[model samples]
Target: MKRELKVTSDGSKTLYMENWDECYHSVHGALNESMHVFIKNGLNEVEADSLHILEFGFGTGLNALLTLSERGGRSIQYTALEKYPLSEEEWNAVAYGRTSEERVAFASIHLADWNAPVEIESGFVLKKVETGFEEVEFEPNSVDLIYYDAFAPSAQPELWTTELFTKCFQTLKPGGFLVTYCAKGQVKRNMKEVGFEVMALPGPPMKREMTKATKPSNV
Candidate 1:
């Protein structure tokens, strides 16, 4: 698995896998994509003093770093799941941070021990879990928001099934949301089948649509 670092449109870096022809984030703009899809649309929608965020693919730790930048006064507990954890050299090569503070925060997020909650900053706690998406189980209704940053259905069709969305729906609390960069018709239908009220939103960069699924408050 050979990966190379490439600069995105927004002047941010992303890891591109040569063999799979996959990128950790969008080529249009890694920073722009994350800020638009995950932070602006996903995180900002959750009105909470304390947020428990569960992320599917912790590739590059870009979303978490951006969340740290936008957390404001909220206390955030971020749990990121990754099966094949990147090495120090790999994450170090993908420089996603700009300022001195953000650079340090990015390093702290990656250096923290796996499976243990580490307070990366005053208002942010990070826990990196080393496990594949299907292998782990979560306590029902445990998460406040989920950043479903998995590869496209084209790359991993098995992950986009109703069974996985059912697990995602069950794991989210009432009124919680699941935001993803994918808006495939089948994906939205699968989410709806598992009792999620799905919404189609404008996507970032060159994409047309994104999906935001909600576990209704009355559920």
Candidate 2:
């Protein structure tokens, strides 16, 4: 797959895969899309004092960086799954952090050891798992939130299947939510069939809607 870097509407860079014809983040605005879909809609909606988040596809590490930047003295345990990890050149091409300290924090996120928990900062801990979704064993009811930032259903239909959503539902704690930029009808139906209460919310720029699914609290 050939990858090209392009600046988004908000002046942030994103990876465009020529083979898949998909952009890693929204072409309208990569940073804005990440902030709205993952942070504002997913993270802010949860009231937990501390969070244990599971992210699907840690692509450019934009969601993780934004989440870390927004931590308000709250403890966060972030577990990101990436089967095809990005190269140093690919990630370094993105410019999310402006200041020296922010840039250092951004670099540390990529440099963190995989398959083990490492404290990136005072309140942020990251565990990068390098494996396919089907191969790993998820501890039941351990996650508080999920960032389902996988490629579009058109590009990777396997990740959006009901079987996987069922597994995601099982991995999440009661009341935990999963957020994604995909709002295809079948995707929502798959989630609902797997015991998630799905909702469609306003999307990022150039997108009409996004999906957020929640596990029932009483389940």
Candidate 3:
């Protein structure tokens, strides 16, 4: 797969995959999309002193970077799953982390060991798993939140299937939610079938809607 770096609407850079015709982040604004979809709609919505977050696609590590910076002193245990990890050249090509702390955290996120827990910073533990999510058996009812940042359903239809969403629902702790920049009707239906209460919210710059699927606390 050929990758090219392109500047988004917000002047942030994203990788464009020619083979898939998809970008690692939104073309409208990489930073904005990460902030809107994952941070604002996903992380901030949960009120917890500590968080166990599971990310579907580690891609550019932008979502992890933002979460580290915006966690608001909460203890965060972040577990990211990546099938094909990015090269140093690929991960370093993005325009993220303008400040000193952000730059260091961003670098650490990429440099951390896979299949092992690494403390990237105080109160922030990162575990980078080098395998597809389908192959991993996540402990049921354990995750506090999920960053469902997989590629678009068009590119990988299998990923957005009911089976996958059922796994996501099973992994989430009661009241925990999964957020993504995807709002396809079928995707929401799949989530609902697995007992997640789905919400279609306004999307980021280039998108119209995004999905937030939550597991009910009582369930």
Candidate 4:
């Protein structure tokens, strides 16, 4: 799988996989999509003193970097899953971290050890899990939020199956929510089949819709 660096619409870089015709983030704007989909729509929806988040497809650690940067006085325990971790060459090619502080944060995120939790900074603990989403096991009712940032269903249909979303339902606490850039009808149906209250939200640039699935509080 050969990956090349592509400058997105927002001047940020994303990995373009020639083999799968897939990209690590949206081509419209890599940073734009991440902030809109994962931060605004996902993290902002939850209001708590502390949060436990499970993210699928860690990719270049962009989402984690953004979340850590937005501390807002709340503590976050982040567990990210990455089946195919990015190599140093791929990540280094990204043109992020304009400021010296941001550059340091980016370096700290990528340098963290895998399969073990490390406090990248005060109030931000990150655990990088080197495993596939389906193969990973999570403690039931433990996660408060799920960033389902896996590749599109077209690229990896197995990750979008009803069974996997069922596992997501079980892993999340009551009233927890899962967010993703995908809003395909079948994907929404699969989430519904597993007792998730699904909603279609506005997508990022060059896209139409995104999905936000929630576990009911009473269930």
TM-score of each: 0.97, 0.97, 0.98, 0.98
Better-scoring candidate (TM-score), 2 or 3: 3
lDDT of 1 at 60: 88
State how far residue 185 of model 3 sits from its true place (Å).
0.6
Per-residue accuracy of model 1 over 1-219 as CA lDDT, tens digit each: 688889888888888877667888999999889999999999999989998999999988999999999988899999999987888999998876879989988998889999999999997999989998998899999999999998788888888889999899999999999999999999999999999999999999998989999999898
* Local accuracy by lDDT, each model: 0.91, 0.92, 0.93, 0.91
* CA shift of 17, model 1, Å: 1.8
Cα lDDT, model 1, residue 138? 93
Error of 3 at 78 (Å): 0.1
Supply the TM-score for candidate 3. Answer: 0.98
TM-score for candidate 2: 0.97
Our tally of clashes for model 1 stands at 0
Model 4 C-alpha lDDT per residue in residues 1-80, reported as the tens digit of each score: 68889999999999987877899999899999999999999888899989999998899899998888775879999999
| TM match of model 4 to true structure | 0.98
Native-to-model Cα distance after best TM-score fit, residue 161 in candidate 1, in Å? 1.2
- Put down candidate 3 lDDT per residue, 1-219, tens digits, no spaces: 688999999998999888789999998999999999999999899899998999999999999999999999999999999998889998887847969889888999999999999999999999999998789899999999999999999998989989999999999999999999999999999999989999999999979999999999998
- Which runs of model 2 end up more than 4 angstroms from their true locations? none
The lowest-lDDT stretch of 10 consecutive residues in candidate 1 is: 12-21
